[model samples]
Target: MRRDDLYITVPSLFRCPISLDVMKSPVSLCTGVTYDRASIQRWLDSGNNTCPATMQVLQSKEFVPNRTLQRLIQIWSDSVARRQLDAESAAANLSVVPSQEQVKVLVKQLDNNCYSSLEKIVSFAKESEENREFLATMDGFLDTVFDFMRNADSDIKLIEQVVKILDLILSKVSEKKPLLESSCLSTILLVLQRGSLDSQIQSVRLLESIAAVGGESKLKLAEKEGLLTELVKSISKDKDPRLIEASLSCLIAITMPKRVKTKLIQFRTIPELKNLISEPNTSVSTIEKSLKLLETLSSCKEGKAEIWHDSVLLQAVVQKVLKVSSKTTEHAVTILWVVCYLFRDEKAQEAVVSSNGMTKFLLLMQSNCSPAVRQMSADLLKIFRVNSKSCLSSYDTKTTHIMPF
Candidate 1:
């Protein structure tokens, strides 16, 4: 057992009051105190007339079998056992390192329906960076994977494995154009919409890789019917933070096109982003990406107008300032600066002031925030200070809060 498992808390009710351990055989004495059979038997044999737990004299020396408690304890123990087994199995799979001969054999045996061999190759690829590079360099590995992908349409299990393997080795593979083919795009779209969470994450990352190869390829990807919709839909679904981050990454890569940005807004990406960043359990990385995506959306006139009108979103953006990592702080500050400082939206400025955003700006000015951020901070502070008629500008500000130019 791992050291951590030693600290796993067993349910108190499942434990023997006398032994302080999970009851192997729970029995209740006449006093209605349940104890492990062995422990209570020893107590009774010691000529004790009282129950160890209750300190009450037994009406009868006989103990009744507690079948219900015993069964409950058994179920709890079995679940813990299964959980430990699954953890051990996963760890074992991660630690397995296959040799080059083993990888080559698996690649040779690969076919459209050969899920096991492909799964093994994927496992090997995931074992280490060295294994991925080695697989990428293999003579027939790419050819075999491509052939399998061609005939594996709608075979979600096969496609999930194939996509994962490809994603693992994609960077090492020199030529990425084949992934842009019609059949391959269809497979990627299918996985994005229907595959398991892991597969969906891989599919989005695959799209990110393809989009990185700019020019006509990026344009072609952006123009794929229903492609942008699915990517935006993934963000709105908010299924997993990993999926949200991956989808945001892909959208950031491909959304340089104005049409794509418009479509994303039409799909309600902004509202979804609002809900995501507002969530307390959201990871810092996801929050950073969410803010970055929001900043991207705010660059457009329509997007800026939409964000400016959502008071809750503006407040959420304000709350993120200096709350998480510096990257998130920067993104959050930039979004605020755009709507409040650049565009001079009164409602947004009031929202910021109401959310204690001025304090964040004051602190940011004196901190190690970047010059651009500092400048934006200065601009926001000026926006509030200069509006003498607004009630928010009445707060006391020390000279130190505003850096001298």
Candidate 2:
């Protein structure tokens, strides 16, 4: 409709009931009342959008000032802004306000959802050419966003997001060198310690990432923090075996081969941990987890020492599993099988001979028992014969990887 038509047709709607004039500000009403722009805008923003006097319903979307009206409002607003700037300039006796280039930069950052564009922002932060102040601001922005992400629930994706946060943190530590020296490193560790089971598990996986990025000093710092032992212990005690298995796998993956033996030995993990491998009656997850821990522990040179150790830890581990009245016979034999295989390794063979481990092997073979026991005895006997430089081969060589799996 034409302005004139609107004016004529809507005269009553425009007039404020109380003032009863030409409705100077084009007052609106609901249920026989009137309100100004501020009140109406407040109501609209709150999702109410109702006229006060007549209680007339209003859809906030319908109140747009079209091209002509908007242009007029902008002209007035620009004049007001210009006057303020002029006044500020005059007070400081300067031609213009100090550059608010910062506002523009922040606007761009907010406009592009730049926070979610993690890699780009992080790489930009790393660039030497970027203004140092700008980098600082960008870091603050990213930190805000990361803090929000840390609130996501404990689903897999949430954990994955935490991993992303951790990776970015690691990247910062790499580039900044002094970054992890701050409280953020401690905070990151705390989050990993307390995150969901899956997140906790991935926290273990981050070991290798940290190893890759963290130099020797930082690595020792990590060790001082006791994170490795904490990670393994968390998995080792988990009721869900897969988590334990994953933890061990990642631990092994991250550990340097040379350091593995010492670390495991320091933790006293050899035989006490090894007993879980042959757990036949347990959930496959449990059995699998035990095997994985064993696998990782055995990957080092000192693992050979367990088989031939004068400590008899290996015999004790196998015996512990055999002693379990809960379906452990197969597991026991499997333990023996693993010991035999390790014995074939020259280091282990030498250790065994030095330790006189052969005496126990002979004893198990001679023990009178069920045929299954005899069969296992014969298997180990054949293995000893084949590998022993001894005259008689007791294991038939057919049943080596033969666990009850």
Q: lDDT: which candidate is best? A: 1
Worst 10 residues of 1 by lDDT: 396-405
Model 2 Cα lDDT, one tens digit per residue, 190-238:
5456666545655555554545554563354345465556655655431
What residue runs in model 1 are displaced by over 4 Å at the alpha carbon?
A: 1-98, 152-154, 387-405
Per-prediction backbone clash count: 0, 18
**Model 2 residue 256 lDDT score:** 47
Q: What do the candidate models score in CA lDDT, each in turn?
A: 0.81, 0.46
Alpha-carbon TM-score of each model against the true structure: 0.70, 0.37
Alpha-carbon runs more than 4 Å astray in model 2: 1-185, 208-224, 278-289, 292-296, 299-302, 307-383, 386-405
- Compared with the true structure, the alpha-carbon lDDT of candidate 1 equals 0.81
